[model samples]
Target: MASDFDDPGYDYAVSVAGRAVRTMAEQRIPPMPTNFAIWFQYYAGSHNNLRNAIDLLIDHNRPFDVSTNQDLFETCIAPEVSAVVVETSERLQA
Candidate 1:
């Protein structure tokens, strides 16, 4: 059977990954999973709130310190992570 997933292929994936890493380095954000997720989403244009929040921070010359990263992850990514966990749990139970 054919897959439904729309794979962006290896090259596109590599480009996005590179951009994510570069962004993290530029912002001095650690290469933690949550931080990478934020940047990847930002470059991918997947999450507008995250993109806007980071942009606003940049505009204000605010540092992406630990507290800021935590806040952004919780506000933007935690809910999605929670939903995925719940869905995976349900599937496993079934």
Candidate 2:
């Protein structure tokens, strides 16, 4: 749980949904609305396995370099596609 997640440019919604979309690609899952819903639900779950890693990082109170942002996203959120979920969640979070 390093402060890397606290980057000044960080957008929580973008990070979450961006990962979902990247997960879709990595899993070869189509980016349909229904599928997106499933991915987002899992990301948002209180006991989410993926997010748990993030929680653990925070619990450790570690510090990460800004250069590790992609690693943070892939390891905690999704993969290395992009950093903006510029569609639905973007609008919703806004």
Candidate 3:
């Protein structure tokens, strides 16, 4: 799969993700879609999560796209995410 994006191959990531999304779209199993939604929601924390989710979806024979995971971690947080308090305060003042 890694080789798909490099020499001897190109857009392998896109291909894999596309296949995963297609597989998931055609799934007929119960609790499977629910499980997928739950995991997908949890992985929305970062771009890596998106990539990992795509990988998981592909491994499970579903369709997905790596770009869908883009900018997953672009948010700027404080050293401990405590900066939210300050951000909220500033927003309120504005």
Candidate 1 positional error at 43, Å:
0.8
Q: Model 2, range 1-94, lDDT digits (tens) per residue?
A: 2222234344765776888798768656567664564455446453265456545655886433333333444554542123343443666888
Q: What residue pairs clash in candidate 3, if any at all?
A: 17-64, 19-62, 19-63, 20-62, 20-63, 21-62, 21-63, 21-64, 22-63
The parts of candidate 2 lying over 4 Å away from their true place are 1-10, 47-94
Best by TM-score: 1
Distance from true location, Cα of 34 in model 3, Å: 19
- Between prediction 1 and prediction 3, the one with superior lDDT is 1
Task: Check candidate 2 and list the clashing pairs.
Answer: 1-57, 1-58
User: How many clashes show up in model 2?
Assistant: 2
Model 3, 25-70: lDDT tens digits are 5553223433343333333333344456556666987533332322
Cα lDDT computed for each candidate against the true fold: 0.82, 0.51, 0.40
Error of 3 at 12 (Å): 20
Residue 37 of model 3, lDDT score:
36
Q: Return the TM-score for candidate 2, rounded to 2 decimals.
A: 0.38
TM per prediction: 0.83, 0.38, 0.22
Worst 10 residues of 2 by lDDT: 1-10
Q: RMSD in Å for candidate 2, one decimal?
A: 14.4
